[model samples]
Target chain A: MLPEENVREYYMIRDIRDTPKALDAVVKSLDGISEVAASARKFRKIFFIGCGSSYYAVLFGSWPLMKNGSVLAFALPSSELILHFSDAVNSDSLVVGVSRSGRTAETLKALEICRGKGAYTVGFTIEGGSEITGIVDEPVVLDIGEEKSIIMTKSFTAFSLSTAMFSSILSERISGEKQTLIDECKAIPSLARSLLSYEDKIAATSKRLLSENIERFIFLGSGPSYPIALEGALKVKETSYVATEGLHLLEFRHGPMATIGERLTLVISCFLGENTVHLKNFVSEFAGKGADIILISNSIDLGESTLKLPPEYSGECKALLSIIPMQILAYYYAVGKGRDPDKPRNLSRYIQRF
Target chain B: MLPEENVREYYMIRDIRDTPKALDAVVKSLDGISEVAASARKFRKIFFIGCGSSYYAVLFGSWPLMKNGSVLAFALPSSELILHFSDAVNSDSLVVGVSRSGRTAETLKALEICRGKGAYTVGFTIEGGSEITGIVDEPVVLDIGEEKSIIMTKSFTAFSLSTAMFSSILSERISGEKQTLIDECKAIPSLARSLLSYEDKIAATSKRLLSENIERFIFLGSGPSYPIALEGALKVKETSYVATEGLHLLEFRHGPMATIGERLTLVISCFLGENTVHLKNFVSEFAGKGADIILISNSIDLGESTLKLPPEYSGECKALLSIIPMQILAYYYAVGKGRDPDKPRNLSRYIQRF
Candidate 1:
């Protein structure tokens, strides 16, 4: 048996490193994803639902369908869906519930409510025989192994990839044309492997942040990358108990920019979309305000602080890759702060109570 | 000429105190709101778009339509709509743009995009001659006077009330029955005045929080009240430059509960809905963790920390009233922190740049 200290030291980082394998496992399960997509294509509206990290994953996954504009796709928190939005579900709607543990009370209940409303329900999870698999009409269970740590690392990536694949396949089925997003997704597993090689640099950055006495973090992203920013902030908050907030790049300027100071670190997920110039200008303007900047992008390196991803990935694929550096940062930040990433206070693997 | 100190002293509190008058003005403009609702009822989908505080207002305003479940109603950040979700807009859609100043660049651009896509567009704003009024097909200009302070208080309430009224009228048009929400809203001006009478109590609570050296705040709400939580958090950040976050009440238990500690204040916007028990249990559990609890509710008061609201209002109307205490709290918190709420750093009356 592994010693307690050894298990604690390795659990979170091991899950972080296993993300590439998780992506590969999801790639291998494309046939299962396609089956869900086939069922999804018949619906006029799709609701992607989950809780916590899974909610962020579904948000990332729903981007392709949202951008395609052929059908209405809404990403909602499961509790919100169950409590307020269940009435929106009907026979013509498809509800996709994602839960890493497949036992999130709100998500399972949300799926039940949607089913009661006569909507097509699909469950995405790593657990094959969990409560979600039984409740959902169709369950796309990923083969990715479980994480020893409570903090989601590989499972988040795998669930996000699976949902993105589902969206891509569904988009293809609707348009009767092949999607390049599927092809772009195929490159992620290898790209994610390369991202993990920057652990030392990420650790050094974390050390530098600790040395600077950074009091809080603000993550910013645009379009498909917005969910990544949210998940990044959640990751840091859960792992290190940091005071962090995530916002749409432009939304930050609206009010949150008031919190900008030398003690604040801005982690931006940058995409080479129409708003690239605006994002660049925003970074420079905030940098001038004494805030530390860390740009995670597939294109346009702003400065030495930028964490560059493989330039080939774009759109939703780049959004998927953007979370890798954030995961690594959260890990090292927790370690630097002498906190156990494997056991965050006041949280569990899945919320059982409402 | 008035002294600088006098201007600084009155600007924010004066705006907060003017909320009742703004509600009265919006109530008097029911005819204009009805005209916009008449146009909105013809659409199958409704998109409520805004930026910052206006964004939160639109969210609160979109609740009645969202709850009715006849038409698809989405509340989105204007920047997100312009950069990503614009494709969802079509000829059968109604896009309502809300901006206090009617000159927020993103909201104006989003309205233009919706118009170009052949969708009907309506502008809701305080400024009659602003750019949005010129760009949108219809403008429901509120007669609520300009805010003396840069931080939105009266304008937020006025905009939220106008939108809520629009949603209620649209719902009544679709259902061919009178909506109780509108009748409930008619009582808001007086209810708001009564709420303002609790200013001394709110100020004492703010003083207690400051004395305790509360490092940060997390505001929580559910259903329609979620936007109020977001707006409350934003108001504090904008006014006091504090590290704050807002989450759906249940979403807080997911990952953010990890941040619960002695210096943390959980400001919950509680409602007497299906999840009332859940909200009560959540507050007690967190209180056990040594976190300060501030419950804002209409029907329930768990302890001394609970800020009671008038019990008659329910649903959307109750949600609108929930923000008054938060606005007052934000104002006093800023003043207690030795910061001028009227002169928040790195902010302007309206964001002109993208």
Candidate 2:
């Protein structure tokens, strides 16, 4: 067992260690819940809504499904589901409301609206028998230890699996490939443990990064990796209490790249959408302007890049997994800076009223 | 005429006094000609590619047409259009490559792809026969001015009107909203001019903001206003040299909102939308978190609430008129920081790469 600080401050480290057991439980539970919807005639569209980390999880999770099918899926901030875009509620829409607590106000309001509108609502959360189960047409509750913290970790992981499983099942049914994505998910914990072995390196890198004078953090990705950059930027800022941003890499040059302040830190997730030559040229331009470049890739083109992410986590998993290291980097930097990694300065968990 | 520093530092500020009648012919007369589009009807999509300021203008200018018609319009940060997502090129598409100067690498490469794919192309640039016309369709050469010290002043304004006109004409026949929108675009400049007249108040606010420890800027809106917030944030950052970000007011709370540092200058634009309540709540949350919240509303509320906007600048002018203050704020802030408002810190008018 680890100390409380070790346990809380480094949840990803802890999660990578305990993933297998958690994955086993999450898989069976997701299967059971999804079965409820399996009997339905059809789902007109897929809508994923959640708050905080779970909300961030949806950014990447829903992408595969969207790319695969014509299913119109919207991932709204849990609050917005109730506040606006509400007329969208209907029996034809399948609402997937995610909440680690199963008790966040905005998400609960959304679930109730779902019930009122007679929509087929699916709920994924840390604990069951709360409002999520009460409102959802079929609720899958896993008693992950995520319910204990204000900052989400295991819940985000759990949320990703749910997104993957749902999309994989839909994809499986559509393509008839029948490739066992669920089985692949089972290997994630073990694979993650291998990935976590590099934790010390990432932490050390974070320390070194702290020594530098990066005024802004720019995380850039393309294709489905785009939203992952958004989440990575968000998580780091929330945890590290730093000024950070994310954008599509090449977009940097046209205008916003000017802000690659002399002390700019560029984080790249090298995937295969854009031309390699163009990326190299842009990277060189920043290098010419004195920017520190950090590449996260499965390829070795960029020397000594930070995270060596698998080119393909096979499906949506890559998108979800790609964000972890950046999140950890943020946490370590926050911890190193003696700021509360959980409660960042001058911000709140939810902005309820204007 | 405005002082040399103001116009030289920022074009948004440069145009405040309005384009001088003395420079109109100089800005409009093109010395050379280029037209590669032999046929027009077979083209399926009209793709506009530019970077930064030029691209932001594209967002605002091409919007009404995109929302109203089926002509299928898309925008790329000239870099992205060239480096990535450039595979769709073919002789069947009309690619309008835009720039203040006919030389950005990405725009140029995109044009090359258009030509290679045998697609029709057009160039909307301040300088003619520079590098870009070599690859475009009908290079509609329009020179905005010699006022160019690299920062785009006359060019962007001209680009906005030109691009809007082009897209609107293509779309109006389909949506039947062309005349109304065009009339609205015409009202925008005058409305914007009136807003610019409030330079005193705007500058005062800018000077006061200079005192705050503001490290981040967040812009929020939904529906049509969502993209406007992006444009607004870009303007502020480009002109003011401020580290600004944009989010759907509601999405902020999901996770990113957690990073709203103590020094947030929150700009909330209330465009009529389904997310109005969510927008209101987001503003309140920022206020609660000790953020300096400024509500930009055309709909006047009671005292101390909003800086009442001039009446809707006629029908179609509402959205364009609403964004003028943001441009002004960006300009003034840039001046307050003693940076070149026209040629922001490290930006270029064109990006020409392989």
Candidate 3:
């Protein structure tokens, strides 16, 4: 299927194939930590730092690192890193700094603090010799999918994709899954190519999704899907400029669901926790309330026009895939409204200086 | 001070004083959480639960509890109690449930799960004889103001005020400051009344704030002020529907400073650790960037309007006090826009079903 034919999972597939080199470069470059890998796993914990979309990637990425047997992994925004929290980073701590542009002031400051605290430091940045490069024990330059327009598209996905592969590598090193990880990661790019062939169809589906004059957007998922829900809402909020909210499927019933109606656009992430049957029921409940549903999952039970991501990616991968459609959905939604898709009205990609 | 006062800090003086029996009457008429209260004090860790505004109240209130030695505490939404994080709680855990109506479905459900797990539970509500009472070992009800508005005016403050007092009470138990707790709490109503007496002035000040037509809104405070910044943003988000954001003064330069203009409205909380001089410099930095400044604290040294609350609170109390002006700011902004303060167009105080 092509982007125009399926119109559901196209961007997701394209995103997978489109950002491979960036992902591969990051993996190969950041593999060493001595001059850059730091004091031989010297930290008690690895704190991944970023904000907004980057913060989200760190969150999802933290899961795999947790499986690496380092449960102390935490994702925090660079802003929070500098503001209230202390370097509570001991000499043994490792701070993995992440930024697409490599210029976000807080990330630079955080790297400075990590080094100042005599802790291990490493960074993933798009630009080499940027301020971030000078502050690291090892700096991995990943200039993947650099975007000229402000709102992050290719860069965000590439960064997250690279983090995923990195997590797999870490998981392999610590959890004894080396062979499987190597095999899987090697297959990812080709798999991504297969997915991209459906871009035309996903694009068509996205156009249909934007046809409704939706004033309210509610996105739902569970487990790892939780972060995807947040990202989905963020994409819509920053790009489409809509009143969007993201919450776990069941959590919506807690209080936010009271605002649901025909005017609302409800997006559900299907590749969720082990037991998504209840989530399916939760989606049905929304349907009962006259809300439209957009399902993105590896499973087909999510109803018609579902974006069936390849089976190789489930669980957290399902969550990763969820990001693609929402990105395209927002991109298409923005252009349809005669608004610029590249540079949203009140937002910037780098958030420089302020 | 009257509602129209330009003075800041409206403690629940008049309202609480008008209903002296609120503490005892409400406590006795409802149910007492004597058993849970007694047992909860012995937990290794405690978790507070609620939804939306109520959920945020627990987050803001938890810091004092943390400082007092319940260092492993977490404030979670009731809806999340059993879904994604049921593993976090068990028979050994202590749980506090907070809700304005006392009957929030998710809160009740969460309480049921807690009791089912044999975890000790305390239920705080504005009314009695509901699911919360049925599920909790002890239920504390304070029906002080029957908040009629859907947007939750008096109820939000009442919850924050009562929770602060409760935390102070618990803090006293931990640090043997019971007498001080009672004395301090007893003094709040008068402080609130005195502040309320200046209501007319605040309303006038708020009128000017709304008229400023500031292009951006930035709130600053340290420590507990971080949560006040969150609450302030939540209020503004729900009310005037503006793109308002809050950050600690320390992190003000992260990225938000780039968009500063005279049209920017900078609300600075000046109580304890206010960093007023730094804040003035901050405002000057923004003014240099052409951003306007609005000051709110126990005191303000220069420029813009000063929301001067009497220095009767610190730590969490400062947070409790700091919220007053922002609430007024949101309320007046809503009123100025001719939007109903009680009922915003696309929102609900609670979402009863999925």
Candidate 4:
């Protein structure tokens, strides 16, 4: 067994490592997921509200709903929803509140407001008895997603997968692709376990990259992978004190690409789907600008600095595994920088207020 | 008269100064505005499409459409819409393509896809007879918003204001506000002129802030102001080569707040609204983190380090004026860093392809 203090120092890694098992638990919660899916289809519009990591998770989750479930879905940060777009809440709308702690203030307030407006409210929380369970009309709790560390790791993945599962179930009911999506989701644990085997390689690459004096980090992804870039960048910033940003894959070519220089490293989440050509072009452009490039994808032999994932996971499941390498990169960088992975400076386990 | 070299050197500043007149031209084009509004209301949902500064403009513009016009609106990057969310386009949807030059490749392609889906398309462009104009069902061209420099300044403000005008007109039909929103919009040019009067002061502040050895910039805003923060950050990163990011005002507290340090400056767009208290608290917290703070707002005073916009430009018009100081700050910072603001390195006036 690892020493207790050393183990505690790597709480984030432990949480991240538990994602496969956590995902299995979420898959076994079939009854709650079905009920949640049924409640979701009842509304004309759905708003996914959360704070920080959960908000990024909403961004990733909303795509599957729009693409698969054919729903009018939106991912709005809780404060933005409550302060600016509250007028958008109506009886035809559904509010899906996401929180690991289940007591995020702005999310709770937004859920309460939506409920008051006669909108259906659903809660996706890691804690079964949290306040959100009592407030939401339909509550789906995945205790396996609960994390002891302040920064979110396992919860984001589990909740994102759960959202994809719900979306797939909704789509299968309409499209008659029975058992396919569920089968794909069940494959994630084994795929994730295989991906974890590449951690030693990622750590070595991260250490070498850190030595290059890269001053800025740009993480790019498209479609469902887009929000993973956001979550990855935020984790790196919060944990490592590095200046980081995330942008939609092709959108970077427009103007922000001007920021690329010798001091920047471009981390592209390469899914090699419909966006493969464009993503490769983005990589080439940044490479021409003299910035270091790292591609995280299922494809092997994408040249140097590539972190390879298992190639077999298809559809929504690819989105689940794509973010794993980035999480590992952020963790290694934090550890190399001598920062505590479990307790990043100036951040708490949960943000309670402004 | 200023010498030719001096004028060429600071052409961006002149463009920033021209925003008021540019806004007047958009407001004066009422026939086109009314036609666009009527067409806009015909759709069940609206997608605002653009790239780079135009995308940020779309983000700023989509707010009033949802808030006042009661439309389901989204600001999708041109590439994201074309590559990922294409399925969300339907016959009942309206696609509003916003481009400064009207030749942005992804925006044009996305518009074509939406048109193919039998969706009504609207073009908000500075160039007449451009490809977007030929494609959109309803084309509103504002030549006065055109820019000679690679960086966008006047065009973003003009198009954002034009969107506000269109949204307000739609709201008038629903709420019968009797031209109040239009009146507020017409007040923008002069208000912008008043705001530009502080350019010298803003330059001084930029000098002081840059002298502090700041390595990172975090721009913050809320509501319509939020997109301004994004655009501001992008402009600074483009022009100054400084690592920069923008986020919703209070959302900064959740996690990225950990990035705050003595080497960073927090530039916030402050508007006295329902979120004023929370925004102020965010500013104070960052201050306590030892980050330099600059507030751009219509408020009389928020103590030192605040750039005061001309008071009495009430309502959504304040959102238009709030971005000017930021543009100026980016310009001065670029010049201070000895970089050319007119032609930022590794960027073009418009993106032609991936």
Top candidate (DockQ):
1
Q: In model 1, which regions exceed 4 Å deviation?
A: A1-8, A175-178, B1-8, B175-178
Q: List the DockQ of the predictions in order.
A: 0.67, 0.30, 0.15, 0.61
- The digit string of per-residue lDDT tens for model 1 on B215-271 reads 689998888889999999999988888789888888888899898862678898886
Order of candidates by lDDT, top first? Answer: 1, 4, 2, 3
Q: Which of the predicted structures, 1 or 4, would earn the higher DockQ when compared with the native?
A: 1
lDDT by candidate, in order shown: 0.85, 0.62, 0.60, 0.79
The C-alpha RMSD in Å for every predicted model, in order, reads 3.1, 5.7, 6.8, 3.0
- Docking quality class, candidate 1: medium
* B232-336: candidate 4 lDDT, tens digit per residue: 999898888888888888788788888765278888887755556556666777777876788887653456788765557546557767789899888988887
| Candidate 4 chain B worst ten-residue window by lDDT | B1-10
Highest-TM-score candidate: 1
**Ranking of predictions according to DockQ:** 1, 4, 2, 3
lDDT tens per residue, model 4, A1-354: 224325234888888889888888887886678877775556667788889889888777666666643446778899988887777788988788898988898899999999999888888999989999999999889969558788889898888878777766766665555736567777777787788887778777778777986657988887777888888889889888888888888878777778776388878887755556556665776776776778887653357688755558545458657778888888888887788978877888777774
Between prediction 1 and prediction 2, which has the larger lDDT? 1
The parts of candidate 4 lying over 4 Å away from their true place are A1-9, A39-41, A68-70, A170-183, B1-8, B39-41, B68-70, B171-180
